[model samples]
Each structure stands twice: as structure tokens, then as C-alpha cells.
Target: MLIGGILRDSSFFCIKMSAYPFFYPMAFPQWKEKLLYWADSRFSYFALTQGNEHSYPQNPFDSCFFAGNKELSENDLWQKRAFKVGVLGYDFKNQIEKLESNNPEFFSLPDLCFFVPELIFKIDSEGIYASSRLSAEFLSEIETQVIPETGSVTCKISPQITRESYLKSVQNIQNEISEGNTYEANFCQAYSGEFETWSPIAAFLRLNQLSRMPFAALFKAKNNWLVSASPERFLKKSGSSLIAQPIKGTIRRGETASQDSENRKKLLASEKERAENLMITDLMRNDLARVSKTGTVRVEELFGIYPFPRVLQMISTVCSELNPDTSLKEIIRATFPMGSMTGAPKISTMKIIEREESFKRGWFSGAFGWIDESGDFDFSVIIRSIIADSEAKKLYFGVGSAITIDASAAQEYEECELKAQAILELLRGN
Candidate 1:
């Protein structure tokens, strides 16, 4: 099965780069601008930001930037091709990640396995697409220019747990910490409401513009749409080296320039934030060690403070040398539903989280990214994101913070708001 835009002109370059049927079109310098087009013309669409906004010769063959629409569901048969895109729901942890989830589900994703998209478009200076045969009218419609505008779509957002309830949950987690059951746990809450006419494409565009995160992604599969501006990279594989940058600490950005600088410094100097970031970093290192060569797991960066549009985050990069024979599935099994999202003593903490949190996380904290045929992959934590169910007319976003021994429940609640600010504002047409 094939997909993509109709070739308007033979001048639009084409290259027989591989054994598979593909076409390389050399038009539209900015591939992201084509998202609305694909989302409208095809049933599946995915866009990964490569952070190449001003770079020249932007279409590198190995560049991470890619957009595509699924031709059909190959089900679990993803080994045939090097490329597949989809979400791994949180519940999948019960089977693959070796954790149990007995809590009832509030929002569930359709699939946990990789999906082979029908039409894959790799974004570069020249975009790549599968050959298609659609009507000229439809083709023209897709190619038409879109003047981006923030839609005035509003939805009533109510937290699943009230402030008092969240505080009580935090205290419960601290009790577990005090009991030595777990060192830290991530606590999250769901903010959801109905927006029957919400436009995913527009919301994603505005969200991305507001916060151009390193791992930003916009994905749509059937009725579900995910718009992410996540800065934490769950896992990335390049050749034999594996990298996971887990983010654990966050502070809201300051009001003024000096204040912002001071906030960054404060985060850098905060023992609490550093301890939180260090724990997650160590957790990731241990997770990678499972699939990595013995003595290969190492922390490359620790407590590295990075400023975002809304918050200042402390991130750490953990690196390891992968065992060549390690399969993609094994790698994911060793480390998924990323530690940053799960917390330390993974299995035990997850059990506590399930018992405490009000809603099933679903895809909110799950990983999403591409896996090439060569077994190379890069996935980002699904944080700072919005999930919209167009069919159900409901939109949901989850926000959480790491709860440690010395954590303040009130402060943690505020952190969730800071993390959610951008998407919330975009949804409110702010």
C-alpha cells in the first residue's frame, strides 16, 4: 500500500535511493508546514522535530526529522521494514517491562506495538514520500498555503485530584520512602475536558512554536492525537552507543532576565533538585546496564541545568555501550516507561503509583519515536504533552513531579502547573 501527495511536476526531484518504492520531492523548504496537509489528506501523520531550524543542507539522510502517514496496520509485523511509528501505552509495562498494572484504566491507547506507516515522509531540505495516486483537486488542496493562526478553542479543565488529595497522595508516597520501599516516586494528575471541535494540527503548531523542545513531536493515529513538547529523551541509539537523558528537577522560569538567571543558578545549587536529578540519572544508568556491555554504563552529564520557555530543568545524560546482539525489544524491556517517569526501584514504585494515582496514565508518560530498519531508535518521554480524542471530543493532559523524602507537596503541585502552562495556554487560545 502506498500514500502521499500527488506529484505536481516532473521537476520535483525523485531519487531511487533504495530497493523500496519512494520519491524525493524538492519543494517546500519547511517540511513542518506540510503537517496540516498530511493530517487532512491521510489517516496517519507524525512529525519529529530535529532542531534544524536554521541549518543548511537540512535534508541529511540520517536526520531525525521525519513525517509520515500510515498506509495500513502491519499489526506486530514490524521487522520487515526499518521504519515504524506508534505509541507504547503505559499498560504495556505489565507484559514487556515486567511490571503489573491492576488499576482500572481511564484513558487507553489502541496499540502497544510498533506500526508500519503506509506513507512515510522523511523531512530534510528535500522531503521524501511514497508515490501516490490521488485526485488533482485533493493534491492541490494539500499543497495550498496555510497561514498559521492560533484557534480560539476552549475547554474546561478540571484536575482529577484536588490540591488536598494530591497532597495526601504525596504524603503517602513519602511514607513509602520513609519505609525504604522506594527512594522516590513520580506523582501525576490528569486535567481533562471536552472540546468537540479542537484542531490537533493548529494546537500542535502553536505549542511547538511556544516551546521548541529537543524531542518535540506531533503524532496522529486514527482518532487519537499526541502533541508533545518534551525535553527529556527517553533513549537514543546511534550505532553501538546508547544514551538516556532523564530529567527529574524543574523550577518555573523567573519573571525578569536576572531573575531567570538566578533561578537557573538556584536550580543548579539546590541540593534537593540535584539529589532528585542524580537519583533518576543513576536509575537510568542501571536500566541501560541491563542491555549494555559490563562496566559500560556511565553518567556523562549530571545535574545539568537547562532553561526552557516555561521552566528551568535539571537534566542528566546517562550513556552505555550496547551489546551488539541486544535486540530492540530487549533494550526497551530493560528500560521503558522511562525511569524519569516511573521513579526509582521501578517495579515497586510503579505498584505504589498505580495504587495511588486516580487515572491510568495510558500514553501520557509512555515513550514515542522512530525505530529505523538498522535497529537505530530515539524516543522521548511523553511529558509536557496533550492527547486529544477527536472521536470522543475529549482532551487530556497529565502533569507530575518527583516526590522524594524532603519533597513539598504544595510545591510539587505548582510544578505540574508550570510544566503544563504552555499547552494549557495554547488550548485556551492565550
Candidate 2:
């Protein structure tokens, strides 16, 4: 039998079992070639109940892991029923212009890389299920391997930009907003450091434990690793329906319950924050409209506040229905480098970003997710992430906030610091 152009015997073989404690610890260290583990924290506060919730069927495996595979190019992603997992870099937006830069490259990763896995694990409330093309005896042997104890790692990292420089950049963007050059721009800064001795698996586990974000993921390919605790979903395709959740506003969580309620109220009522979110929401709608069926583009949820462990974010959901014939490349071309990251007036803002940002973003603002055998896919925006090159013993992370006309330079700087807090604590071995 043949399925999706691959022999059925070579396709996934699945087994259902109770959740095992050693699954992550045992698997992480061995699958250094390619591994991706994604978790949806299922936090109580994230109640996204609007827009096609009942109309569209949901994907069964929201939380899953992929291991074992060879790299596939972006061109291969659109093949019929091609099941692959990968990351898309922000530099993919360079197709708009022949942009050139002299900034140093912290992690020399490709713009796009995908892989076909021989093993897959899907986790849900029901339990954990394992699927693989490998022999069952080999998997049984993996189950018997001993789990290693966690190790200590030390890191010293600093922002690549000074406070004065960051504030100056904010003022520059505000000036551009005033001049109608762009409505809003997401300006980012990079932090780079070296670690004495490190365990990539342990570091990711620790980071995931602290953040507990809804879109948490750990992906390793060769010497490059992406440990992400992102709270935003860039895009999801289910059947003919497409969804985008873009986060635009941020405020630190209050210490007390009452203070937290007050902060949420402030974020919801603030004119500036609302404007920032509205601009991006509109941009997303337009982007989807470009590739969607007529009359199917709509804003599902606007300015919905959601809470993570460290902060509260204002996220909006926009959805559309695509033609069955739409290709992955076409959808990405219409909406790559998501709106929340690029700002309003995407092309113009991207040009400004290329000029103003101190370093190349690379995969920082890109997305990571999987494409199923049925061609349905989901991806999360790459924020609140640590990108590392183990061979060089060097690590880098990025933090930024949207800048608008009414934005305060000092407050925006503080916001960036707030966003960087979790990863900073992780690096300090807290």
C-alpha cells in the first residue's frame, strides 16, 4: 500500500500508552540531528472561543514532537500531503528588496529548513501516543535508557544596544509615525553571550518550566537549537480555514490580584495600545484577504487580553477561508514575517527595520511549527526565544515592542526589558 507517495510500511506506526516521565529526558539527548517538541500549556486564562470555533474541526494533535529526519528545502514544503516540520526565518522578507547589511551574524542558520521525521509523539488529555517508522524493538530499547541528572550552566549576556541608543531609536520611529512614513514598527534588539559549560536539553526544560507559555517549543537541528516560549500564534490552517493570532500589546503582571486586574484594565483602555493592536489587526486582515476567498476574511477576536506567567498580552485573532488550491508558498508570500513583527504598512516598515535595527533578526522573528500529513499546519511567532550554536558555545536572544506615534520612548524601553526578564533569569541559572 502507498500513502502520500510513501510506502505504508515506511509511514508512521503508532502506539498509545500512558504518559511516561522519562520521554523527554530520554529522547532529547539522543535526537541531536532533528527534534521538535511543542506544548500547549492550556493555561486557564486563555479562552479563545470565537470565530469558527464550532464551524471548523480542530486538529487532533496540538501538542506533539518530531524526531529523526533529513532536511527539506522550502520548495518541497508545498508538495501534496508532504508531512514535514521546520522553521521560517524573518529574512525571507528580503525578497521585497535587495536589502544589504554589515551587521555581525550571531547564529548562521538558514532562512528556511524543514525535515521529515521517522518518529512522532502526540500528547493530549487522553494520553501520549508514539508513532515511528523504526522497529518496535528499537523503541523498547530506548525506553530502558537511563535518564541523566540535570547539570549546572553559567552564562553572561548583555544587550547589544545601550539605553540611550534604544530610546533614541524609539524617538526616531515616533518621528517617522508622525510624518506618516509608517503607522507602527516593531523594533528589536539582540543579546549575545557565551556559556562555560551547557546542556541544551536541560536548558530548554528549565526555560519551558519557567515560562509555561501556550506555544512553547524546543527545536534542535545540528549545532543550532531554538528554545522558544512564545505566547503568540502566527498562523494556522485547518481545512479551508486559515487563522492568525497576532500579539501587539504587553504589560507586566502585577504582584497582587487587584493590581493585576488594574493592569489588565489599563491595557484594555489605553488609547495607544488599542491603536497599536488595531493597526496590526487590520494589516493581518488585509494579508489574509490577498489569498482568501472573497467575503471570507474577518476579525474573529479583537484586543483580547491573555495572561502568561510573567506578563499579560493583548492578542487579536483574524481568520479567512482559502481556496483549496492555494499553495503553501502562496499563503506565505501573502503573509510572511507576520504583521505584529513588521508593523503597519509592511514593506515600508520592513525597510525601516532593516535600517534601524542594530543586528540581523535571522530566526528571532521567524516561525516554528509542523505540517501534518493532511497538509494542515500551525506555527507560532518566534519571540521570547533563545537561539544557540553549541559548537561556538555562543547564545543569542532578542526582545522588542511595537512603536507607534503615541508611544513613550521610556515606557517602550521598559517594555523591552520586561519581555527579556524570563530568558535573563533562565541564563542566570535562577
Candidate 3:
């Protein structure tokens, strides 16, 4: 079954297979030597629906993985149908070199990495589909491999910054807001630990099961792995339409249904939360306006509350019709290290982030997703993720919230804890 299209004999071939429950986990071992990437849209109702119809807007594949052949340079990324998988690190921002602090050498992921894959597998409501430069014989081999059972994983981790230090940083950011240095800033902290026994695939599956987020992904580049259960979309491009969904406000789920309803109401009614979301929404609108057609930028959805297993989030969607002449590089440069990850008056707020954040964000506040043959792409903000370096036996993740003048240092600390709870549970083998 030919998918996408027929290429030359030396190019990729396509096939269709019956969907198997264990396809994702087993594919890892079979393609151990290749750069593997998997993105799953587990909760589609929130991201894929508009009005009464369920349609994938910027993403064509609801769930898919790519086995890459070689890394591609940034200049080569926008070639027609490049079909690349990669990530952009938070340090991609300008004047990153001015920051005095950095993540330790073990967490030194590159600022940018994208690969041209030789094999692709897409799973949808129908079944599994494959496109590859490999032979049909190899494709059959993948189908017959035994599915490995999920294994246990355990680790001990500690926050890089003490609670007092975190609170102090928040206070400093609030001071900056008050002094007119910036309206808001995102201050982040890290947790680091050594793994006792590691099973990357198992840990990823467990995390995916626990979060069941819309933009779940597993990315491997050599010994480094990024297992993400992110619920926020950084950006997307489909035809002339460009969209970005920024998540600003978060509240933990309640123990009971009535309590959960009350909490949602409280989040909706919050003056501080609304202020936070509004500031970033305006930031995004201004950014998108740079590359957008004249007078085309607008906010599509404002303060839309969405639920996950552990928390409910306030997400606002901003969209614009792009200028036909705009290039991929221009689009990214205009709206990256997303506004929610930074803050209002982006440049000054980012400087505050660099000075106040405990460590370099690496890929934490960056993005990961695919660019398809049509030149359309979709990327998720790299939050709620674990960055593991097997060679160093080290694993770490970063979490933060936007701090405005009215922010409470103690309450912001609690918000970070709520964000880290899933990864903490996974590390403890809970």
C-alpha cells in the first residue's frame, strides 16, 4: 500500500500492517541503531476537535515514529518533504552566551538537532502504516519480534535548588515586575538524580500511561533520551494558517467531582491567572504579527480550560495567516522559546529568566515534533519531560510557572511541585 507517494526505487517504499498493541515498545529494540522518535496523541478531544468535527489541523499523523538515517542541518530543514524529526533547545535564544550559568556538562544537549529518517510508521484509527527505504524483508522482521514486558525502574532524585532559594528567586522576579523591568518572567528549577536500574522504554510507557497527555513523545539521539508527556502546543503551520497554543495557568485536580468543578471555577475567576494568560497572549500576538500578513494575527481561543489526569490548564490559542514569502527560519525566530515559557516584554523578561533560573533549560522549554512532506509542521512545548543521559547515569527535568507582580513565592513553589509530581512518581516506581 503506497502512502504519501511513490518515490524512485532508491527512495522510500511503503506498506500497511495490522495494528498491534505492542508495536511502539517492540520497535525500539529492532531499530536500536537508528535515531528513533515517537509522538502519540492520546487525548484527541482537546487538541484535534473544533466545533463538532474532529480534524487534525496541523498534524497529519495522530501517532507516528521515525527511524532517522542522518542528521540534517538547519539550512537544509525546509526542503520540500524533508520529513525530519528533531528539537530546539531553550538556549537557541539570542544572547544565550551572556548567561553566567549553564546546565552541567552531562545535560549538554545541542541547541538544535534534526534528522532525516529512513523509516516511518504512522498509527491512526485505521491501522499501522509504514514507509521506509529499508526492504520488505526487514519490515516483516519488525512485525514478528516478541514484545518485551514492561520492567521496573527506580531512582533517587533531589531538587537542584532549595525551597528557600526558589522562593527567593520568585521574589526577585516579582520585584523586577514591580520596578518596571518586566511585566512577568518564568523562573525555573531542576531535579537531578542517578538511575539505579534503567529501562528507557519501560519508563517512557509508564510515564505515558500516567499522563496520557495529548502531545506525548519519546525521542532518542544516541544515549540521550527525552520522554515527554507535554499537553501544550508551541506552534503549528498548515497551509497559510499558523497557530500557537500557550498554557499559562494551572490548577491541580480535586479529590472529588464537586471539588474539581469548584477548582475549575476558581481558576476561571482568578484575577492573577487571567493577568498571566493575557500578558502572554498579547506577547504571542505581537510576535506572530512580524511574519504574518498585514492585520491577520488574532487570538482564536482565550482562557480555554482543559483537563488532564492530574491537573487542569488554562490554554489560549493564537493564530495568523502567514505571508506566502515567509521562510521556516523566519517563522521560528519570531515565536520561539514560546511566550508562556518566557514572559511579557520578551527580551527583558528572558534576561531575567537567564539570570534567575538555576540551570540552563536545555530542551525543557524548547520544542519537539515533526515537519512533514508538505512543509507543514507541529511541535509541542517540551514540558513535563525527563531528559536522561545513559552514559552519565543522570536524569533531570525542569519545571516552572510564570511570575507576575501579584505572584506568591510560596504558592509558585507549590505549582512547581504539582508539575513535577508525575515524573517523581515514575522515578520512585510508584
The lDDT values for all models are 0.72, 0.73, 0.73
Q: What does candidate 2's lDDT look like per residue over 1-430, in tens digits?
A: 4221222333352222443222323343433211211111111011010011111222212566555546776667767555677788888777634655446788688888777665455544233344323344444444444444534444898889999999888888888888899999999999998876666666666776677777777777777778788777889988889999889888889999999999999999989899999999999999999999999998888998877788988988899999768988888889888999989899888878777889988889998887766667888888998888878888898999999887888999899989988898888866
The ten-residue window of minimal lDDT in model 2 covers: 41-50
Cα RMSDs, all models = 5.0, 6.9, 6.4
lDDT tens per residue, model 3, 99-147: 3335454466877877766555555433344433434544454454444
lDDT of 1 by residue, 104-127 (tens): 454556546354544443445465
Model 1: clashing residue pairs?
59-124, 59-125, 70-117, 70-118, 71-117, 71-118, 82-372, 82-373
Location of the lowest summed lDDT over 10 successive residues in candidate 3? 43-52
TM-scores of the candidates are: 0.85, 0.85, 0.84
TM-score of 3: 0.84
